[model samples]
Target: MGVVSATARSDRYPKQDRSRATRQKLLEAAVACLAEHGWTGSTVTVVAERAGVSRGAAQHHFPTREDLFTAAVEYVAEQRSSALRELPAQDRRSVVAALVDLYTGPLFRAALHLWVAASHEEQLHARVTELEARVGRETHRIAVELLRADESVPGVRETVQGFLDMARGLGLANVLTDDRARRERVVEQWAGLLDGALGD
Candidate 1:
């Protein structure tokens, strides 16, 4: 490979830039279809339509429903990570705060709904479970890495996870409930968990 050709290729593609736009479109479509019809009922054709792309294009990009779902899951995870990129290394509470916003936020609801619906699809259950576990393990890994959970800090993952669980469970409860105050109250409880988790 000549330097000129290599440089030209890099200039045009930049490695990370290639396929990102298409991937984003496909993921958005996947989420849309999943939310509209649930994972079991969401067909690749519907997703293609949602993305305003050819069925062949969708298939070329994803290859299979599982592939698309996994990509969508990963995309969501990446989006979450991007939001917290500026966070300082010393702050574990920032991770917790991001976790709260993630569980209770708008995009997360689509993921949560798609995931729950995915669980009921027999053909996709194992695949969905794998994706869900991947996301969970990432959260745990972040807690471990940032919080430095070791024998001395025995329960870092457990403590962070349990705190998140309460926020998540209550957040879910506010989804259909019309009372805005309830949701705000539940979200504010994170302030308490933040203090406890950060030893402040």
Candidate 2:
């Protein structure tokens, strides 16, 4: 292997404002297209048009379809992530309610779109999986520990994973059913379920 220069390595990851702006535009356009049209319909041309850039520019910024989808998913995931970034000031029940709200909210719709894209597009599959894994990483560990659920729980990552899985399933279900009040009621029920585990 050839020896790499320190300067070259440093410049490899530059912090330039223009580059950041371009990336943000690309990501935003990808999200818009993915949400509105879907993966197959959201071609590079459409994304470029949405971003006010040339198709070549979009391709240069993201060499593959996977890269573009990954950025879009990350952008969408971050919207929900802000809620959990700072700990919410509420009782566990209220907190769980808020978490449930997030599940059945706009972010969930974006994720469902991403999931659909991933299901059909091989290139986007890993990107969508990464987005889901992000949620799993953020919520599952705490949930499992709090529930006193084992980390090696069958078919899941302990308590947190089980709850998150259910939450995701319910989000999709609610979307398909278009039932909001009923979903919140379901959340209330699961909150009671977790409450049972917590010696309530």
Candidate 3:
């Protein structure tokens, strides 16, 4: 085997912004594929084509399918967290509506696919568990920040957790059903409840 210099090793991995952009593109493509077609259809070759990158380059970025999808999960979580952080000052009701919509949208759907796949795949299960915990904590932090709620208040954290659980259940039930009317009503009702609980 040939000895490799430190510079060469650094070059072997993507260290520049352009290379990072390519990796992000691949990850975005993987998320889209997972959301649109589920786990089995999100192969490395398919992701590479969707990303408009060569298969070789895709492999260079992510040598394994699991690595690609795991990174995709992290990318999605980061994107969601960033967007949540930048939520403009809005009426409490509107913010609640927006939060509910987010939990019921594409990012959650893509993650749901991974979660189901993880139920049967050990490697995926481990990755999902770790990433999910981190993402979940970040999401909770963002929600608390956006709401400006005092977690020290009685029942505050539990109430927030309840709302999240309710939103997740609504999203899961909505996968194969047309419940838009009911969903809207439920969101409005929950928004009112949350506002009251927050002393707003």
Candidate 4:
């Protein structure tokens, strides 16, 4: 090949980068729409508009509404999982508090909308079930690593699982009413209990 100009090389990669950027934008917009307005409001057209992209482009990336939303759910989960991996070092109490905040925040709200909608939509139910399982496993992995807790010990695994289940229940409660004070109280108590049982 003849001398490849710098401009040509740069131009070649931008098309792919732009495509990825657009897809990411759509995913993020979908999450925001779901959290703010629920699944009924998160139409592909609405998500595209929120992302500042054309409906055609959104459809090109995600041919079906299910495809778009399922991808969006996975996208948010993966983003949160990645962030969890990079969390700065903190004491057990701080980590537990942070984890509680995460479970009750925007990402959890977005997922709540999807879960409720999925219960009524047969096609969506299957995808959300699978996605939720995968995200759950990843979250568990991150928690275990962060805590360095020995799951092999008797009751340790059950306790951790129970804590996560409790957090999720609290998160669901937070959607309909103000459960912040109760959540804080429970989280602090749980943190202390966990430290007593598992701390170095």
Top of the candidates by TM-score: 4
For 1-200, candidate 4 gives per-residue lDDT tens digits of 44577778788899999999999999999888989999988899999999999999999999998899889888988987788789888788887777677678778999999989999999899999999999888877777777777888888777777777877888998998889988888898999898888757
TM-score of 3: 0.88
Q: Summarize candidate 2's per-residue lDDT along 30-50 as a digit string, tens digits.
A: 877776675667667788888
Write candidate 1's Cα lDDT for 1-200 as tens digits. 99999898888885457466766888987876665566667778888888888899789888988788767766877777665554567655555555566665555666676677676767667877887788777766665555444524556556767765776776577566643576556556765565576463
Off by more than 4 A, model 2: 1-15, 142-157
After superposition, candidate 3 runs with Cα above 4 Å error: 1-15
Maximum-lDDT candidate: 4
Candidate 4 CA-lDDT value: 0.86
Candidate 1 versus truth, CA RMSD in Å, comes to 3.7
- C-alpha RMSD by candidate, in order: 3.7, 5.4, 4.7, 1.8
What clash count goes with each model? Answer: 0, 1, 0, 0
Number of the candidate with higher lDDT, 3 or 4: 4
**Cα lDDT, model 2, residue 44:** 72
Report, for every candidate in turn, its global Cα lDDT versus the true structure. 0.68, 0.69, 0.85, 0.86
Give the runs in model 4 whose Cα sits over 4 Å from its true position.
1-8
Q: If both were scored by TM-score, which would come out higher, candidate 1 or candidate 4?
A: 4
Between candidates 2 and 4, name the one with more favorable TM-score.
4
* Residue 178 displacement (Å), model 3: 4.1
The best-first sequence of candidates by TM-score reads 4, 3, 1, 2
Model 3, C-alpha of 166: deviation from truth (Å):
1.3
Against the hidden reference, what TM-scores do the models get? 0.75, 0.73, 0.88, 0.92
